[model samples]
Target: MTSTAPAQEWPADVRTLAIDVGGSGFKAAILDPAGAMLTERVRVETPYPCPPERLMSSVVDLTQDLGHRDRVSVGFPGLVRNGKVRNIPSLSRTAYDGDTDPALEDAWRGFDLAGALTEAFGVPTKVANDADVQGCAVVSGEGFEFVMTLGTGVGTALFLDGRLLPHIEGGHAPFRKGDTFEEQLGNVARKQIGNERWARRVVEAITAYDRFLFFDTIHVGGGNAKHLDPADLPHKARIVANTAGIIGGVRLWDLDA
Candidate 1:
């Protein structure tokens, strides 16, 4: 996202409900116009076979006790364009480690998540890829910046001079051993391989990513990011807090985030 328009000004009274949808859980919090948390974060375990309707209800349930929200911002794990969903690796599965469900796959295609949430909340809503939303919180507005979020699956986002580039599901791209990045580096892979080996794989993945993109810095976030040891990663790489998903929600309204 790049901005040509002037910055938007939210009235001090506006409260934003920011939701972070992950494979393992759904988390949300109310944010002041300035992005400070206005209420303690609320969370719910994400149910398996989570079709769009179920996911929508989960989001609504999170805000039941948080009072009124002037708008909504969502960080979705799937590929979203124009507020619609595309590929849904996490949500398409029947179980956490199960194979994709064809029925779920068809249901998610072009689902209007932003529109649905807008109507549900009775407010304007914006949705973007989870990694893109997380990247919005961490980028330095310098040269090329990249974010890699390791969760149930992997998520990727890119930015240049503070402007977001288009989204890419880089984790699904080929890596080695006839496996893709998500196949080799996701949470399931980490459990199968152990953190020691997973850390090694992470370094290797970052190295390969650097070779391909040569980012100014690679910020790693998501639930699984804590497993990595900074000493093993390239000097330019840094691990960021998982809370960025919620903290970055306010930026979603900005023209360039």
Candidate 2:
């Protein structure tokens, strides 16, 4: 769904608390209704064995000093459905091998994240996949657009004329050598293989997606985007600011409402 607000009528005084939950970090900021951050963002490293309670506590601590907001919006790095966290891929047991904490991982499954945050912060809240939220900040409202975030893992979002489509876990889909896009292109992979080799994989990823999706434009964002060379990207693809994660949060409320 797309925002109904007219281009010139964006309510300037409406403030929102925008939260971005990633595998490696959690960040929160106060944002103007138009999606620009109004205050310095606060962030903390995501705790390992992040059960729902631990995550919630960290989020609460991160936002404690951000001041008041009329509403809350969250962009989470997982599969969210109807405001609940359906799955947390990066935090799952399979992702950790022997270090896995089954109980903690299970606690995240089906957690009503939006509801919990709303109750804890005393505001209306909305939630969506992190990439879908980022798409809200960057989609140009022309033809088809595809967004990819390469951070702790890969995230994909698609939009048509600025309307976000249903999220697809394309990051988990096989890309090459039986490894998923996340497996081959995430921060872990980049660090493992060195920037030069990782850059090559990113180029390959862009070409592969362009061939299959044929998107008119591709926007790449996330912490790792800074490491990529613009020259290596396709003409249609460009790097976007990491702040898109927080900026896109406000738009999520528009979709939910």
Candidate 3:
């Protein structure tokens, strides 16, 4: 559903809405296209089997009550190709997995999210993987950079040559001891090890990752990121807020084609 309509331009002063969708929760921000927060961020529980219609309606409802905006950017938790979910491998185990949840199944999968959002809001919308969009916000137009989001699951996204590469799915990639990296480094791992141990693991993981990618920089974000004390980290690494979703959403204006 990639649009051929004249590329929509975001108004200089118009506020834009940014959303980051996860399997367990959703976060939204109302801001200028530059990612500046204009209103307090809003979050809602993401019960699995949430029908796409219901989810969209919820967003519309929230925005309508919160106030309307000119653009909407969504960071979805799946492999989005041309604004459609090709495979939701990471989110497949959630409540909506089989579309078995009677309250909402048809609306979750096989829906043209960007298109539906446009129809719902009468404004342009752009969608991408949550981790990918988070990574996009980290790149500083210099060299390769990556982001590892430590939340319900670990998510990794790589940016190369300044353009965002879609659907990297680095979290599911196998790591040591027959476990996926996400399982080892994700929030699940934190719970297994407790906070103090989890922090140590994060340091070691980051050090190894730096060596593996030979990356110029690494950014750590997500809910758990705030818990990480900067003094505990090795070397100089940039730490950013999860709010990158808004800035990355603004980049959609540049991506419209």
Candidate 4:
């Protein structure tokens, strides 16, 4: 199919909710299909012993507060196939780090997240990987695009032909022999280098990533993107912030089509 650029105006009648779920926190916003934020984005710390029931309940509480949004989009940190989380280890490190919480089980290994949200909210829900959704917000399919997010852990997602594919754990991808990219460039790296030094190193890292991937554009976003200084960047890349949920939510249809 020939791809069109994202619309400047969103469909007016559809009200949608977009949620970002991470290892540590959750961020969400209610928006009109036109991509206008209708309510302030709300965030809460993700519960430590994240049983699926509890996680699902947190979402219910958030939507109930919104009252009547008709559509919902959720961004999960793990590998999502047909709205089901296939790998918890990639999404929640604490759950898989061999510190098995009594509350979790293998049954949750691949649960239908879309159906759960639909059942709870009484509205159709579309779910995609958090990194993939973030990539949708910043990359418009103009060329080869790679997005890197530095948050609780490093996240990587790619966008091609105006479509958001499944996320890649580039952070978990091996970097120097045995160490993963996340270990090198993730926020944990912040402790080793102060913000300024980290920014400089980010510049170097992005330059290397660009050259390696031959990417025409590199888009960076995440909780930590705000802490970076554009002046220290090494290449010509767009620094995007503030509108990640809005732009990313617009691509929620990818879950079905």
Task: Choose the strongest candidate by lDDT.
Answer: 1
Q: Would you list the clashing residue pairs of candidate 1?
A: none
TM-score of each prediction: 0.95, 0.91, 0.84, 0.84
| CA RMSD of each candidate after superposition | 2.5, 3.5, 3.4, 4.7
What C-alpha lDDT does candidate 3 achieve relative to the native structure?
0.70
lDDT of 4 by residue, 1-257 (tens): 00112223335577778888877678888877656788888888777567677789886776568756766777777676766666654334444223544336464677877778777777667777677777767777776788887776677777666666556667677665466767666666776677887777678678767766787777888778888877666566767784584458766654334
Backbone N/Cα/C clashes per model: 0, 0, 1, 1
Query: Per-residue lDDT for 30-136 in model 3, tens only?
Result: 77756677788787777554556657876776566546677777887766676666656435443532323422333346668788888887877778778777776
Clashes of 2: 0
Clashing residue pairs found in predicted model 3: 52-107
Question: Model 3, stretches more than 4 Å misplaced?
Answer: 1-6, 89-91, 94-109
Is candidate 1 or 3 superior in TM-score? 1
Candidate number of the best TM-score: 1
Quality of model 1 by C-alpha lDDT:
0.87
lDDT of 1 by residue, 99-171 (tens): 9999999999988888788888887788888999898888898999999999999999998988889999999
The TM-score obtained by model 4 is 0.84
Q: Residue 247 deviation, candidate 1, in Å?
A: 0.9
Better of 1 and 4 by TM-score: 1
The lDDT values for all models are 0.87, 0.83, 0.70, 0.68
- Overall local distance difference test of candidate 4: 0.68
Query: What pairs collide in candidate 4?
Result: 10-34
